[model samples]
Target: MNQYPLWKNLLILGVVLFGILFALPNVFSQDPSIEVSAARGHEVTEATPDEVRAVLQNVGVPFKAVEPLAEDKVLVRFPSSGDQLRGQEAIEAHLADRYNSALTLVADLPGWLRAIDAQPMYLGLDLRGGIQVLIDVDMEAALEQGLERYTGDIRSLLRQEKIRYLTVMNDANRVTVKFGDAETLDKGRKLIDREFRELEFETASDGKNFDLYARLAPAEEEQLRDFALQQNITTLRNRVNALGVAEPIVQRQGERRIVVQLPGAQDPARLKEILGATATLEFRLVDTEGSVQDAVEGRVPVSSRLYYDREGRPVLLKRSVIVTGDQITNATSGFDQNSGTPAVFVNLDSRGARRMREVTTENVGKPMAVVFIENRTVTEMVDGEPVKRQVRTEEVISVANIREPFGRRFQTSGLDSSEEAHNLALFLRAGALAAPIQIVEERTIGPSLGQENIDQGVKSVVYGLAAVLIFMGLYYRIFGLVADLVLLTNLVLIVAILSLLQATLTLPGIAGIVLTMGMAVDANVLIFERIREELRNGSSPQASINAGYGKALSTIVDANITTLIAAVILFSFGTGPVKGFAVTLSVGIFTSMFTAILGSRAVVNLIYGGRRLSKLAI
Candidate 1:
């Protein structure tokens, strides 16, 4: 009755072996290294290794090896974290302003193992060194910008339809188009109702002016805000990916706030530079009929504006924008056909492509300009005091004549270098932020502190496991040894599942593991006690063993199911560390039940199932 079928035995053995294979990678740990990725144009080629070696040699910084990675990246491995830091600084100093370098911990597993794509579970910011930033998005500014765009759209619509309008103005939250007569206002309202379904238009007569007011409905406003937040999150994720940060976290914290955690991020300032800046591109016609000198001398035309280029030369541009950066679906950096100089190739979305075709068809051979706009924040010391300031810069990056009525794909030249072209392409491809974000809080965790936390967490788990093993072994005798083996197997299965899933492990996750260790043997304890009761009742040894597991199964299932429900709830409603704890706890509960009930039974049956005895070991 205690014998397990051959298939059952094989299944258990297979699971154990599978767990061992996945869990073995963790034993190799990670090595201190510096990850080098191109900031913009330069690719990481085979020559990069030699350059890195030369730099290290020049600076007297020792390194183990420099290896090229995928996606134009490279890794410089060092003997220790100290050497990693020193070598990174040396390389940065030598390269000057060429690449973006960050200190990272990479797995030192054998190449054969990596060939199969086996990797260790990622560690979170709390467990590894990184930067955590809290950003608050400006929703009011977003709304105002949306209203301004609406006003511009209404102005263009009226002009296109040849409808007479006195003025179109955007105030705090609404756009008002005033007509000279009520008839014109009615025509404008009908046109808006047919074209713009997202806006609610109302007409009114204020004695002399017949005005049509347009505003977003309450539901539309709410949707716009949500869309802005989500769009910013997506944009930030793209920017972080371009930075080549491994396992970065960019998630919405609340309605208007976002939380960003970059694992193994060494330079917070550089991160802020990328995350905080709002970069976008706009195309408009160059106003050749207007005088730039007159505009610069404060005689600006109403339909045109004056802007400076990268070299501080003023130019006149039409006030209307042809297309914005958000309309760009793709961008790539390559050499121009005729000049062979570096340039950016851009592809527009369907609507943008149509608009481009229309505009170019109307104004062929006229000069057009691509304007690059960036808003950034600078912090500096002023009169021995820390001060923060916001700065906005707009410059024309490219100017070319529209050769024909082409759309969908176009190229922009006149960039300073290939690096600038690459950087611009990356920015355009990432899309523009719907709203600006301000960094309200920033925190950095040093690698040494992270290592200390890891050590303490490991010690806690080891001590807890040792205590549990000793208690179970002493209390249950031979049967207890079987339980101890199952407990170890449970730990392995939990780790293997975690590694296979590639879940991030945090410090709180360690606590969950320690708790799991204590809880793993509960089912075994119940089974052992039930068997003892059966023995006291004078049942046969085999019968008692069979009855113990049968009677204890329900209790084990009931206890674990209830706790699993709690873990699921925690995972659903929790954030960050709490969620991390819940994940491990949930996984542990399942693994423990399998190992304690089924695995232990398989082992016991193989050992004591074949024959009867006068006395049992237990």
Candidate 2:
């Protein structure tokens, strides 16, 4: 045999060594994230800078930053301990005693990055520990929203066609409207089919036998249901996002079911409250001479409303509504010229605009109230008391295109800061969850659990690798030793690449690495067996060595390609665990091919390339 060549082997070894040097630091470097939780039934409202600063300062936690997320919602970063429980307790105590706000302890995590340490990957609730909730939306409420639209449309339709209606009642399943007489009713029915294309009219057998009912099409009924469900989900997502939970999983489960998974979530009940509370808005006329002082002095009338302007100054308005929350598209904070103080700008829908114009045109000088609930201006409190529901416009009412829930930008002014206004926006948007949701499962993983998972995963990998090394050494002799060396290098390269890519390594991912160890040995087995077969054919050592790799290439490619295809499909279709497994499996195949084929090839060529096979025992 020829002398063993060192230079070629050195070149390959140098490349592996270079990869190791480049990859280790990134793999080992870690970032840390903090976790916090909220109590059940508490909703976060906007807090002023001073209010937030005071809470953090009083908590005795060394906070680096205090960010206002929304109303009562905040992100506080502490320099020490990162213990969310401690920070929460302190804030809870402060708010309970000093601010007197109804606050709850919800879960919290670190803002984004901890430069000093590696934080654990923020796992989904299914992967890590947290709460899973499935909510069933009430079909009744959805139907009601649809019914309201129908009632208004039918009333307008009748008035336009000069048809007099004696009764209009919606019975959930169908809408029944009665005309004054048979002749008028027949004309009304024909007009409804001609003008209101969405309705299907038919005569029903009843006491008067004069009812014309319209049944919605199956597709239209389904569309209405979908619209309701979507609006509910959208509102819920907005509410959760405003709370500052990163990656809160909110998706529709079925036709009317919603699935919400709050990873690392502490108080699931608070979610129920925030989601369930329907903050509806309304506009009403304010009575004149109705002031906060009038209410305090017991001189305020039930026909009037007392409201504070953006400057906290009180004003009076009539008690009737010109428009309601349904007509509002959105609201935001702005400035008013009268008192030069901050005020809320209201945006109304087209229907709201028409109503406002009609009311304003009728009552040119009367005052009106703009009330907010859960953050949205819901209804005006008339003269410090609730008034009978009615739609009446006031002269002082300001009409604008800025509608609540408007597609375009609408604003409410009079906020202390831009932060307060933003919170208001989120509150309006969250509206309410379509229905109630209860947490079915929840668990907070302490650092101990995370550390335990890490320890166990490492132990498994170490044991598996040990087994691989022993088996390879016993089976392939010298070739086995070379395989072991390449296998070790392969593991290092895989980790280095994972670290560089910042790919998350779950428990399953570690399993992939162990499986990679076994597959890496297969490459050597194929090459060694090919060499043995060649040598048996009476081929020289150099010829056998060259033929082994050449012959093994086809088999190697076929096996790896099949495995790779499976991995790709798994990665594409699988959700959480399967995806993690696919990633590791895919990475393992690449590393195994490299170390087994290229690494072992280089080492083998070094040994037999220079005709130094005197001690070889193939």
Best by TM-score: 1
- In model 2, the worst 10-residue window by lDDT is 98-107
lDDT of each: 0.82, 0.59
lDDT of 1 by residue, 392-442 (tens): 778998889998998899998878788668867887898878877787886
Q: Tell how far residue 109 is off in model 1, in angstroms.
A: 2.4
Evaluated against the true structure, the overall lDDT of model 1 is: 0.82
Clashing pairs in 1: none
What TM-score do all the candidates reach, one by one? Answer: 0.75, 0.58
Instruction: Report how far off residue 462 is in candidate 2 (Å).
Output: 2.8
After aligning candidate 1 to the native by TM-score, how far in Å is the CA of 495 from where it should be?
1.4
